[model samples]
Target chain A: MLCLIAWVVFGILGLFSVKYRVLAKESFDCVFRRITFKKCNSNLDERIKSKLTGNLMKFSPKMARGVYRHYEFLSWIFVALFVVSLVLGAQGAYNLAMYDNCAGPNADPDQCIFTPDYDVVDCDDPLCDDGHCEECGDDCDCEECS
Target chain B: MMNVEKIRKDFPIFEKKKFIYFDNACMPLRPKVVIDKINEYYTEYPACAGRSYHDFGTRLTDEVANARDLVKKFIGAKKAKEIIFTKNATESINLVANSFKFNSVLTSDREHNSNLLPWQKFDHDVVKSKKDFSFDLESFSDKVKNFDIVSMVHTSNLEGYSLPVKEIIKIAHEQGAKVLLDGAQSVPHKEINVRKLDVDFLAFSGHKMLGPNGVGVLYGKEELLDGMKPFILGGETVSDSTYDSYKLEELPHKFEAGLQNYPGILGLGSAAKYLMKIGRNNIEKHENMLKSKIDIEGVEKIGHVGESGIFNFNIPGKGAHEVAMMLSASKNIMIRSGAHCMHSWFNSRNLEGSARASFYLYNTLEEIDTFVEELEKIKKL
Candidate 1:
């Protein structure tokens, strides 16, 4: 699970650079295979885990052994946190679009909230004068706004 | 203020397992932040310290120095120079037992081998612990005048019983004997002000706490360290080395002796800061509260739970190893069993070892309930 999340994090990083794109593609393929009941490249997972935890051997051999033993369990946690972060970011965006606030219902009107378009606008301001938000203009593309 | 749920969130291990982690006495799980700090070293500055004149090297040196200062503060040392980083507590104890010239060394029977075995090199005697698992302080005080150094564990690893270190140190000092505290079990669980404790030397490992492994600290008084010879000698430990003789470096470097675990040291600094910010009193309180929730009467028990969050118990008609294995296999509950590195102490008593459930700040009462529930099944098994 940790390997999968690490691959995802690496993949997101890979999106920014052409150098890591091939590695990310191969890693994603492995992840997809494992999840979809195909003959996944287990070696790819091992490679990613070693890449992540190999330096730990110098740090402490005992700890390195533990990391290898628990890599599957750790990956699940990493994936869960990644998912949680995605949900939180999405919820924050949702609240901003629907309620014109990131703190959801009881948001302080004086506080500036971030919108989906990366614009920070005060909650007290009239966000949508008509059917569109003033801060995001026509590009205020969000779940509630769309 | 001590929210177990919120605290558990900081430790990623909770989300990774269905088990209640009661093996904290061996190694507490690291928080995500501590892991990030270690990763920061690898990602940002993976350079060697005290060797290269490069920007990364210089920065790494400063970071290591900062960690030293933080550790000094964590243990309440009078100066940062007093803290010496080693591989682990075993190395730290060996450093003192080897370097410090003493006619005879004194130690308790209940010390972890890290503390107990090091005394083999020198003339040493073991003071026994009472049947209640507490140290026989009277025996220690009686023998204090005989030894030049009285080295003892501040806390017992097997029983989790705390020794009367303050009182023992006083008696040892009065007898002109230097005291070294094996603080591996004590430092992570409670606040220890070395100056207040007035111990001559204190040794502990970072992994026992919520820090990375491969880094341990031996804190001695500046004067005591200055007087003692360096255990390991050569490179980075000398200011100048002639063909014939070498001028040793200052207090800590003289002891460090080689290229140290820079990343581990930095992570340890972060761990110390994290624990301090949470306040040791509060961590102790949380562990105490969790201890109160454990129902040990239903399970076959050996000794009462100590103030520190450790319960050592035996199951009737079951080997400790079998009980530990069954617990892990059946319910996924993790614990430590057997002698716990105090083999001499256990052997002397002519008894088989017991299963140990040691808790940390991240443990919850609900988890304790799960542990008890599983132990009940293991008993039936």
Candidate 2:
């Protein structure tokens, strides 16, 4: 399952460095075997797990033990998190394209980076002059203003 | 006792990097003298050893001869001519396997792939190890009479347990069988005298003994080497040639074919000299002392932590490679993992593999402490 994340991370890193390319290929093989219901003969998962746990052992033995013991579970959790993020990102992109806001229609524009900055105007207010709200000083174009 | 600190100074790797190197069984770190010797060959006299008449060639030929003589002396061979240079111990064993006439061959079950693979072509049988993983001498004694040649590893790389070669050779000889000892692991760690052992042949690599790679020695009794034909033939192997037939050179030359690894050979000679200066007995003692300090609980040890420098073990429920990698990642402690080319032994036992940490002369007690500390932390995992 760690190979799932490794495949994506190392795949991108592989494009820039030769060293990561070898690891990327190994992780790719691991992920491929995993999805095909075969064992990962490449041992990429074990290598990553050990390397991570080993480094952790230097600072905290208890933490290292926990990590080593639950490496597979942790890998699954990370993979799940990655999948969730991917799905959310895709949904956000869809909402931004359809309703002009990543959080969907009637949501705050501040919630989405792609949402264009615009002034909030109340066309029915008395403060609205020339069909433009007061808050929309220079860059506002309400229906009445148009 | 060897001054570990002073000895560490000889190897330039120590100066360049800080890591506890425990993979001596795979290959020991090269010392500055060996490196300088190799560099000297490339810088001073980089020419064909035997074929050329120029000064560079003549000098190289002398250096190559000197290296052979050093190797012969190192192994206590009767004559320098008995020493034949090859790429490594594997090639040396292959040369013997190809050239030596034998109806049947016998080997120990704990042979490295190098010693085991070559004899697969012949009528080969393996002597099973004892319950404690020691050499089964009684089993070997019973099997010797049925075989023409007894090929065995002198010192096991898996655990560093040296087979009783002196006794094994005597038994093999009594049964009218010749012996070929794979000294790849033994020759580097301890002193081996072929004449004293009365062994017919011995093969070992130079890289394992603080030398450069791509050079190895095959020491055969002169009479046996004389009876056998050359395994490989080319430029330097022949004295004279005809349109119809060719006459092969004598002894070592016939066995060593083509242009040789001159720099590696010279470096190996320097390595031999370096080992001699340090003393093999000192190395063996220092390693034993270091091995004695390894006291970790809750982990299963592979072999008896005996007099040798190797310590093989596995943390329960943890993969051998995982433990080894963790140790490296935690403290930069280098060790060998997996079956160590002895897959037959591990497979027969139904074991995945064992992590092996082998010590050498330069290895200190402090390093052993760090290794133990790391193992204890890993054992919890």
Candidate 3:
């Protein structure tokens, strides 16, 4: 549980630092090794797992033997989730950098983006009586603005 | 008494997920409305409160003040001015310990570290809990007379054993000692009436009660707060200041120094509203119902499973941490293990720790049954 929590945190921090991204990738590698039943070289994952589940050994040797086998599956699942989160968070940050906001295409631009005048952003039609464009007016389809 | 399905729908964490959360003692899952409120702040009006006179600043100030009022009502405080917002319960307790005037302090063995370390600066005496996980009231009574302040945990996170605070407060008052209730566990799970308890100070964390992290409450009596010194000092806490002479602001404002957490406080206000709408009495009843029928084979209970949502136990021969880990890995179940920050209680009894599963309003009977089934599998392991 502690290991997964750390990975999730590091994954979030990976957004700001490449060093954290490296650490998260190493952690993910450890999880991947467990999934493939490879000879794991990373002692950090094993140490964390042992320290966390150490109480079980004292509680009952039998229970420890039974449940320890499943730790690998949990590690894999957590790493997978961390990867997804890191990818989506990066994508959002990328979108926000390129555009003023990272809102979904279907999202209302008024609520998602900041602007002094809504009229300028929404005015898609060249023809306008007042500053508001009639095509993108109250009954406008609103797709052309996006 | 609450509609479980309807209540669960309010929380987005449950959406598109079949996972069960029993970590309420650590941090409760936030509701969608609270998340929406947070997002709304950053998107629409991201401005500092009490620092500007513009439209955005005025709206932010009102939101912060409104949040303080909501917290005051939630804990049954005498006035809104009595509520001081801090980062968490640890900060709140530290604030009272550092600010209050006291020569000696009294606490108990079952206290979390937040309630313990803050008093170590003074001549502190600790009353131990009995072997059965109950507080030794006689020890408390004998020690109360020697201390000027009685700081205590309202409920033990280890066993969910609630201290007899009303009677304890009466005894402390008779001995001319002011009391501080560590309401971290009690405030979220039970209804807290500071006015009725008559405690001088009450501290609790918002995250443990379905609100955002990094936001908590330190509620003091209006008079006591006025008398106590400020914990943190900077821009927001001062009215007027010079090189050598400075004047602090009144009540809550004096304690809340620096830029405040406006979004988090708004989230907490929403959490308070959510809890109130469901009714605290109903939550208590539902949790009690869940605690009563908790069935497990060959597990040893650490403390009395009273009228609380907390359950602490160990597999007869299985280590508590092992059980917690195995359950999480195999079933995605989350339960707390270890000393639970009550090292004094566990070390005194020659025990390491017990596995703890805490429930909240969002928890269901189905989750408990699933937990027991997983426990059965761990027994085979």
Choose the strongest candidate by TM-score: 2
What candidate 2 keeps of the native contacts, as a fraction, is: 0.97
TM-score of each: 0.71, 0.92, 0.75
Each candidate's fnat: 0.00, 0.97, 0.11
lDDT of 1 by residue, B1-381 (tens): 687788889988678777678899999999988899899899988998888889899989889999999999998999999999998889999999888888899988887888888898778898976777677888888988999998888877775778899899999999999999999988998999999999999999999989999999999999989999987897788899888999988888999887788889999999999898888888877877777777655566554346767888887765676567655654567889888987887788787788888888888887888777766554443
The digit string of per-residue lDDT tens for model 3 on B1-381 reads: 688988999988788776778878888889998898888788877899987999888988888888888888999998999999999899999999999998999998778999998888789988877766677888888889999999999987876789999999999999999999999998888888999999999999989888898999999998999999986899778899999978999888899998888888988988888787788888878988888778776888887646788989888766777677667765678888888888877887899898999888988998889888777766655
> Which ranking of candidates, highest TM-score first?
2, 3, 1
DockQ-based CAPRI category assigned to the predicted complex of candidate 2? medium
User: Which is the better candidate, 1 or 2, if ranked by DockQ?
Assistant: 2
Model 1, position B78, has a per-residue lDDT of: 91
- Sorted into a CAPRI-style docking class, model 1 comes out as incorrect
For candidate 2, lDDT tens digit of each residue in B1-381?
Answer: 688889998888898888999999999999999999999998999999988889999999999999999998899999999999999999999999999999899999899999999999999999998888888899999999999999999999988899999999999999999999999999988988899999999999999999889999999999999999987888878999998788999988999898899999999999999998888988988888899899988988896446888999888888899989998999999999999999988998899899999999999989999999998888767
lDDT at residue B304 of model 3 (Cα atoms)? 60
Candidate 2 CA-lDDT value: 0.91
